[model samples]
Target: MLVEGIKSRPVYHGIAADPRARRHIFVLEGEGARALLEQEPSLTPAILASTEILYVARGSAGEGHVEALSALGADVAWTAPTVETLLFRLKAMLAVAHMGTRLYISGTEGFIGKAMQVALDQGMDYSTIPTEHRGSLARRVQCVHCKGVTEDVATTPFTCSHCGLSLLVRDHYSRRLGAFQGVCIDAEEPGVRPEPEALFL
Candidate 1:
């Protein structure tokens, strides 16, 4: 149980726990992540004041969330992380291992997978802070065209009825599906390839 009186108001338990967090940085992504952060104004500022925060905006199309965060006085450093950037961030996180830093990530499944792999490669203890615990919805990938969001379906076909222009779905299943016997028309790339049904599993 944690309690704090700030400006004569009792602080939430989550806020009280921020000081105990050893991680010097928190990574944020996805739309849900931004919404949650917006809801908890105190926690964001508290976390920033106590430690550093890394904002990964890969796959996010707009700057609204980033702008709002900056307005909140969050000391965030923004970066568009590629596969190579992922490796670099991982290395940086591991270099501070003795400090017992924690990482908070919110993004598409692909981004999450890469981030988790990096954390595991560095031997860092990784945990998913529930939306309730962190006061945010779990991360999700939204279709670039339809805006359909979910974690159940990893692949999003980008032929949108609205725009009719082929939009690229970040972390599209074809990239993860690899080579298979069945046929697949890649959203990011033109052309069809044999993709096995069992290969998806």
Candidate 2:
């Protein structure tokens, strides 16, 4: 979820859990993965066949689901993996992945975008990859002043971790920067401050 919520953002259509896909890659992040499995019941059997399930969990949140999916004869792996590692692995997989492969992804907005970027780099089209977004409303904010960026920012009017200045998170997102722009909130009027509003609350 982002500021205006999932509906306002680009939507991802999910592949039904049926075993229609010759090769299936499932990327599930966080506890919300359970919902995905439940929604697409056929996905379970697909996982048992040629599906590769990549699950990223925070702490113990993904443990139970991972176990259940694994027990059902699905090849499931879990982690709170770094973007570099995930991207590297995805690149390696894409190098050998074929045309009939289907990608089912679900996670926070940033995670989905990061994964989609990798998929696009590998020449995978939107029709081959269906996505479902879940979880928190955090922003990956980029600081224009120091050319530094931050992720998982819970709200606007936050201080920049890189530049140590109060910044206001903007609605605009830069795919090249991999974050939304966060400009100095009071740059226009030195002493003037706007009333704070809780975003996505």
Best by lDDT: 2
RMSD of 1: 13.7
Tell me the TM-score of model 2.
Answer: 0.78
- Candidate 2, overall lDDT? 0.67
How well does candidate 1 score on lDDT at residue 123?
A: 65
Clashing pairs in 2: 17-42, 17-43
List where candidate 2 sits over 4 angstroms from the true fold: 1-8, 12-19, 44-47, 59-63, 75-84, 126-128
Could you give candidate 2's per-residue lDDT for residues 1-201 as a string of tens digits? Answer: 124542324555643554566777777767546645675445455456777777767423636876665555665454436555766777778889986777777777677777777888777775567777677767677899998888788776877899877778777676545467788878888646565556732
Candidate 1: C-alpha lDDT: 0.42
Give the alpha carbon lDDT tens digit for every residue of 103-159 in model 1.
Answer: 555444444445555666666653433211222222233344444433322233333
Model 1 clashing residue pairs (backbone): 23-101, 23-102, 181-196, 182-194, 182-195, 182-196, 183-195
After superposition, which runs of candidate 1 have C-alpha atoms over 4 Å from their true positions?
Answer: 1-17, 32-36, 44-46, 81-83, 127-201
